[model samples]
Target chain A: MGPSLLLRAEGLKRQLGDRLLWSQLNLVLAAGDRLGLVAPSGAGKTLLLRALALLDPLQAGTISLQGRPPATWGLPRWRSMVLYLAQRPTAHGGTVEANLRSPWEFQELRGRGGWRYERIKGWLQALGRDPSFLAYDAERLSGGELQLLALLRALQFDPSVLLLDEPTASLDGATTAALEALLIEWLAAGQRACVFTSHDSEQIQRFATRTLELRP
Target chain B: MTPMTSGALTISDGRLALSALLILVNVGLSAALRLGLTRSLLVASLRMVVQLLLVGFVLEWLFRQDHAPLIVLVGAAMAMIAGISAVQRTRRRFAGIYLNSLLSVMASSALVTGLAVTGLIQPQPWYDPQYLIPLLGMVLGNTLNGISLGLDRFMEGLRSGRDQVETALALGATRWEACQEVVRDAIRVAMIPTINSMMVMGLVSLPGMMTGQILQGATPDAAVRYQIVILFMIASATALGVFGVVGLAYGRLTSADHQLRLDRLVG
Candidate 1:
């Protein structure tokens, strides 16, 4: 049998007024699994990602993470373990380091729970960037730079589950390839599981252990 | 430039020239900045010039007649214009709702200032052209600014960061709890400039009313007393007008269910 399921969704449904976005959806993400969610524009991929992150309420049925129902888990605890990277990848405050370390400001990260400075620096280097970028203003960063920063921020949470929406949509080819290599390394480490959505089929085939498509 | 003497323009010679020059300088600076606000600046300048000239002639006529109803009519028209100006400055998602908000602002400001000046200050002839017109204008104008700032910031906060706001809601936050951050920011921004201006009024700068009074040859002590009274009236009017319009507009922007009407905004 596969590793114990880290997340499970059953009979999940959402309706925006009269329009049904998703219905009767079922999914399970096991530990170490790298899952890719594919959908056409407006097929509610972002909504589903948000729902899985417990940022959006599912209209029907249930979702559980690590055998605890979302209703049972404390909000801060749930969010700490399940980091979500939104599509926009925009950060609120000044400086790249400040954005990357935003979770540190959260009450949940108090006392030995802070993101390791060394690990963050290492990751930045791996992404072909350095400590120099950390001092740069977040608003001044290009889209690709912001996207990478957002991914780095998610990783800083030390989450058991990472949900990213089109994380590479703005990246250059070299950065995209580097991101794929990072994903492979992350999966190989077997410490965290990831679920992401992307339009590039080649990247999906290379990185996605299993893929699910959201239909119109 | 036309070789024209300043006195030929109107009865109040130097004061008119100064006000006109100040307005022209503001307009020129706005154009230089390429703020895409030339149309608004031009229209506002034209409105101020024409309105002041017309009001001057009308007040001259009213003073000669010494009739109360005609003076009250002028005040009412000024209040109406002030209300409309407040609404135009406020950026709302549903622009159609601005009319109601504007009316609310006007009513609140007018009721507060009208009662204070006419009933309490009670200048001779109660509707004296000197006291009634300028005092009412200051109160109405300041209140208009507060109304605009409060409404505009509130709507902008709702529009931009909508996803985060909705996320808070989905996290079982009450509607007020979900919107608390935005509300706080908007209200703080709206109140700050007013508070700052009031704090710095006498020391850093003499306000427009006081300056006008000084220029018009009123004693400095008398001008200061009128300024103090007018300032108090304006502060009260601004608070009431801003609060009323914001409270009403906030309710109307959301449905009974408390979802933001995103599509309704032309912005």
Candidate 2:
């Protein structure tokens, strides 16, 4: 691995009870790399993504950020840079604005300071969300809306790499295109990278520079 | 008015024999309704009789002892037994729960008992067995309930809210911050019974200690004032016990890297 790589995992393995989810896996996300993770249903695509994001423990492997093992970089520090966005994320019960503003209250993020409303409103606008969307009660939002808010929260944190699990699965075609555009804008902003798991190969062809497929 | 003392009234051998009617009523009802509890009723009654006889003899010896250290030993033994029972009542098993519960129960019981002997009850010679035993028993009993309720809620909450906890961790929150809500919930669950009892203390019914004190020929005013102190003491002890156990569990249930060691939780 060269210095260009932002995140890497080697010989990764995960298990559920006595059943093996996957074994002897390797993954790499470099600067500006768009990696598409494709696998059939029940193939543990989310599990692998979570493992790469450091949300799930590695059964037998090593995950490194900037060539440092997670142990040395520290989880909070590592995860702050290498983020994972779940398929269906849960939020603290509040308005959309409150949900977006919540993570900043965390001590780790506290040193990074708070979210900027103008910047978030700009990002939300790129996703075709109006300013009023921020004021909407988060509990009442639809699945797609929730995903958008989740994505927006992740994007605002400026993570260098993102493990997106079925991020656009619930969005309509127009919103999906807007999400792609928003992601592109995010990538273009800095030394950023993304991994997306989607059934839509067409979206992968357009968005990801390469793809990894998991077999049952 | 000065408090009057009455001679201790003893239940005679005939009266003690007549107390068997309580068991008879249960057995008779089980047979009449086909409730199938007759065997359990008989066993429980027999166990209670034998256990009480042994405890009575032991209490007699404890009361006779002029030694102060005997008080500590007895209190510790009671706390250990209460701790075991508290952990046993939790349907879920937690790693290192025995130590956690035992420490919490001992700490709360000791602290509350110390306060009682030093200030509130102020039994002369402090280690006076009569006051120490009953006070320790009451503190241990309430602390036991609080700890069991806390352990049950904390484990169940962590299991059910794993995702939420994980999400918070991923967002760079520490383990304590991530599980803050669940910890708060555990405290609430543990404190509920004590709170409810306080609420209904005098209005709905007479409480146990008050009833016993009144039956022992204490004036109603004295009984009521003692009950007030007792209610406050109970609530304080329960909070301390619940916090000690639940707070210790948070450390045990997570790793240094802020990951939840949910696997540590057994059946």
Candidate 3:
């Protein structure tokens, strides 16, 4: 593994019951890499992302972050560094700010100096939202707004690698562009990388530096 | 039948048969109302009578035995049955559910009952079947209910709220952090019945053991003291039992790697 490699997966395999989804899959993520994943429906794209984040079990494979296996870093720390963002995000019954702040309650993230309200407000501004957006009830937010909230929630944690699964499916074009710009700015700041899937080919071409296709 | 020296009335076989005939009234009502419960009513009544009679004979024999190990064996058997019945009452199950229930029910009931028998009541020989058996039975009964309700709620909550749980996990929440709310909800639900019963215990209804003791010629004051102690023991046992079962369930449903292992759950 090179010093620039952020994550690596080797000989990954997954099977759903009696049917084989995929096997012998490999991925390498380096710093500032924006890797777009393309796969047909039922091609196990989401499962691949989940497997990379260790959210779901793998039949046979090894995933390492910064050349260290998950066992050495421990599950919580490993997941904190390599986070997954779901397509349809869920929010607890509280204000948007509460949803964003919820991740800090975990012991693994507690010592990261906690979330900065000003930094979130700044991100919200970049996403074209005002400060009062934090006060809105999270459960009552529209789908697009919820997606923004989910993005903010993950971004605030400062993860090393983000596995985004159709994060902008519900967002309109303008909001989606803002989100992409925000992500670009985020990538430029640190040795961060992202693996995302988009149904829109134009968006993928515009955003991803390179692309990987999964054939069933 | 002969009356006891304490003047407690003894029911003869003929009188007991007369009491058994009372179920005809339920059967008649069910028939008239077209409720279709007549067969079930009759079968349930018969089952209750047969089961109680068997238990009566068993208790009589058990009370006569002077061996401590035999008495302990019977208590262990009761706890085992209670444990199995607890899991059987749940709608959802996972692998190791039976073992989890057995460990929780047995440990909590035994702990509370042992403390009450040896420390508080201080019965002669400490394992006297007369005192230890009934106390253990009462504790086990209530603890079983708590474990069943707690486990059921925990599993159901996880199934229904999978999205929310996974959301938390995706954001790097630990297994306990992801599940703390459901675990709290389960424990609260399990403790509700016990708390409600305690609230209305004396005013709403005289407890069964108290009534039985009074009928057996014990003074009302002595029976009341025993009932109070029994109530306290039951509450402690139920709290501990609910905690134990919920904690065990949390372990089963989540992994050390901070993953939510919902696949381990089965209907």
Candidate 4:
């Protein structure tokens, strides 16, 4: 069989007020899969992404992490394994490192432990920044820089699936290229999967090995 | 003690009428500015006068009765009214909102007021109307505002900061972790006015309760001591109320799965 599935969404239906965003939707992500979602604006790309991440509730659908229902896995544990990085990344006050450190402080994450300093240092270097970047004030970071921090924050968790909602929308060409390269290396390093929703067709063509097109 | 030995003065009806003369300024200003509030001002004044008169009569009758159950009944009624007023001020709607506010009011008022009356004041009978009613009234009033302000701030914060909260949740936070910042900020905002009032009490102005005691002939020394005691009582009551209301609202707005139930809130 193909590589074992990391996450699956079956018969997913989303409704916004009287409008139906999507119905009878099915999606699957196997290990090392780079799944891209292409949709016109307001096609519920973000909603679908959030629903998979369990940030938004589905009208009538069940999301399974691995082969089991999310309820069996526990929400906090399931969420840690399937992280959602929003389009417009933001952080509370403190240094960039603090933004990364905050999640570990949660009780759910406390028992799971934290990242090694070397891995974060290596990720920063891979993103074309040095270790000193950790000292940058989170609130003072530019939009592009905040996106980088957001990506690194979730990546450090070593989730099985990464749902990126227009993750590179604010990045310049060089940063986007760097981020894409880093993500490719990360996926290759483990049996991880990634799903992205972006307007950039070129980025999709270059990055996504499989594509799901949605019509409004 | 003899009449002069009391060392207190009472206002005669004529002097009280002279005090009423202050309303003419409000009347003239309303007319001059076309504020159109003259009717409202008069109605408010009339309501205040009538309500206070009725309450005074009721209290006189209550003080004469040595029955303890009446004190409990009146205190319960006062707390119920304060709780409803607190909810009205917030202007938020949810299921069992009355119970939400009422539980907080009763818990905070009972715990703190109970402590002050039994531990400090210790009047002859535990339910002495002279001590219990006024203490309950003041504590209830201050806590009503605290809980209201706290609930309003919390609801508004969650409504606006939905994304931030969800982001934290998606990153593996429990509902408590996701909303802790908003909760703390809201409660802090709720407590600020009470804190500021405490800071400026002696310097800025004598509080109404103290001034009233002084005007009615209690010595300044005794009034100041009583004011200090009541200030502490109010502070405790407000903190307890804020704690109770925030806890309840959070419990109401979230579910066992740690979902933020924004749909539960009504416009």
| Chain B vs. true chain B: TM-score per candidate | 0.75, 0.94, 0.96, 0.95
Checking candidate 4 for backbone clashes, the offending pairs are none
| lDDT of predicted model 3 | 0.90
Off by over 4 Å in 1: A14-19, A54-61, A67-78, A92-94, A108-112, A172-174, A184-191, B1-89, B94-141, B157-220, B236-267
- Enumerate residue pairs that collide in model 1: none
Stretches of candidate 2 exceeding 4 Å from the true structure? A1-3, A17-20, A71-73, A111-113, A213-216, B1-8, B22-46, B221-225
lDDT of 4 by residue, A1-216 (tens): 878788888889988888988888888899999999988899999988888877766789788987999889888888888989999987888998888988898877887668678999988888899888999999899999999999999998889999999999889899899999999999988879999988988989999999987653
Candidate 3 CAPRI assessment class: medium
lDDT by residue (tens digit), candidate 2, B240-260 = 999999999998898777888
Assess every candidate by TM-score. 0.62, 0.89, 0.95, 0.90
Best model number under lDDT: 3
Q: Write the per-residue lDDT of candidate 3 for residues A168-213, one digit (tens) a residue.
A: 9998888899999999999889989999999999989999998988
Q: Choose 3 or 4, whichever is better by DockQ.
A: 3
Pick the winner on TM-score between candidates 2 and 3: 3
Give the number of the best model, judged by DockQ: 3
- Candidates' chain A TM-scores: 0.93, 0.94, 0.97, 0.96
Interface quality of candidate 3 as DockQ: 0.74
lDDT of 2 at B109: 85
Worst 10 residues of 2 chain A by lDDT: A1-10
- Each candidate: fraction of true contacts kept? 0.02, 0.53, 0.65, 0.68
